[model samples]
Target: MNYGMVFLSIISNRFFDLLDVLNKLNELKLFTLFINIKEILLDLRIPKSKQMRTLEQWFEEYAVSHQNPKNKAIHYVCVPAIFFSIVGLLMSIPSGFIANTLKLNAPIIENWAVVVLLFVLVFYIRLSVAMAIKIAIFSAICLVANYYIGQVFPLWIFSIGVFVIAWIGQFYGHNIEGKKPSFLKDLQFLMIGPAWVVENLFSKK
Candidate 1:
């Protein structure tokens, strides 16, 4: 597999797990759901197009082909629902820790920083709903995992360990496909890794 596939697989696994959790929480209020969807979608880094209508039309077509007719809207809504829930839970942990350590009035304010960052990402990029959902899920898992890993191992050591493991999986996937890894040509392929898996899942459906 190539590095891209490896990165994508890890992200896919985490997102699938999160989807399981979101399925159980599908009863949230409409306004809350809309806000969460907006917040989570805001984290995509897609480049803008001069004609957004064309892009929207393309996405609509893609959605119809990839998503079940009965569940198309649900998929978009649920994907982000799962993503933001995981992020909210994971970020709260460190935010509480930081608040206690620094004696802050509102430790939860740290989450606002994350919110601001997501706003910047969405404003700059134009990712599909599925892509945004997958990225959000995987990014949250990586952040939480990295935090705990850093406590056990030095940051550099932990990073190197993850890099080695990730690369090995990636090369294995590439060996099966017999194609050059996407990352070798464009760094943005790094972001596409997770989205690719999500697309595959949708295609299967």
Candidate 2:
């Protein structure tokens, strides 16, 4: 007769024990979730400050000396004009074999600018993919502009004049800056200059 009461008591005790275990498990799960979230936030905060800066950093570094208002003003025109002139100079080379191979109706389509600028684009891409894309687009426009300019006048002669004059202006700006141009030390600065200009312009706005 007493067996039934004892059996009920045993069942009640086991139920309470199970409830206690479940509560502890729930508390443990909440604590673990909190720890994971805290760790994730810490990871996000830490790596960014420690990681190396991107190509943009290099641009800003080069820009230090160029901060002189006179120098900054000169670069706004000279950098792009120099780039365009280089494209024009390359285009001035006689089409030769390239003219016949593609047989495109537009002479400019298969001209030296496209061939030469491809390598330049790869150079830019190696530095920074996003900047490279922007430069590639701008270079394509310059090539098309060169094609038209070539139609009206002596292209190579004009480009050389532009290149020399622009460079003179650049050096004059640097003199005012009282710091040497970055390109003076490393030729890579030549490629980086245009991107630096583009990034600076956007950052200014």
- lDDT, candidate 2, equals 0.85
lDDT value, residue 116 of candidate 1? 45
Worst 10 residues of 1 by lDDT: 65-74
Top candidate, metric TM-score: 2
Candidate 2 residue lDDT tens string, 136-177: 889988988998999999999999999999999999999999
TM-score of 2: 0.70
Clashes of 1: 10
For residues 1-205, what per-residue lDDT tens digits would candidate 1 score against the true structure?
5999999999999999888777666655555788888988975545454235343454444333333333433334433333333444444344555566666574334443355437634632575655565555656564566455546666445455445555555555455545555557545444444454456455555
Clashing pairs in 1: 1-170, 1-171, 1-172, 1-173, 1-174, 2-170, 2-174, 45-125, 46-125, 46-126
lDDT for residue 43 in candidate 2, whole number 0-100: 74
Candidates' TM-scores? 0.39, 0.70
Task: At residue 183, give the lDDT of candidate 2.
Answer: 78
**Relative to the true structure, how large is the alpha-carbon lDDT of every model?**
0.51, 0.85
Worst 10 residues of 2 by lDDT: 44-53
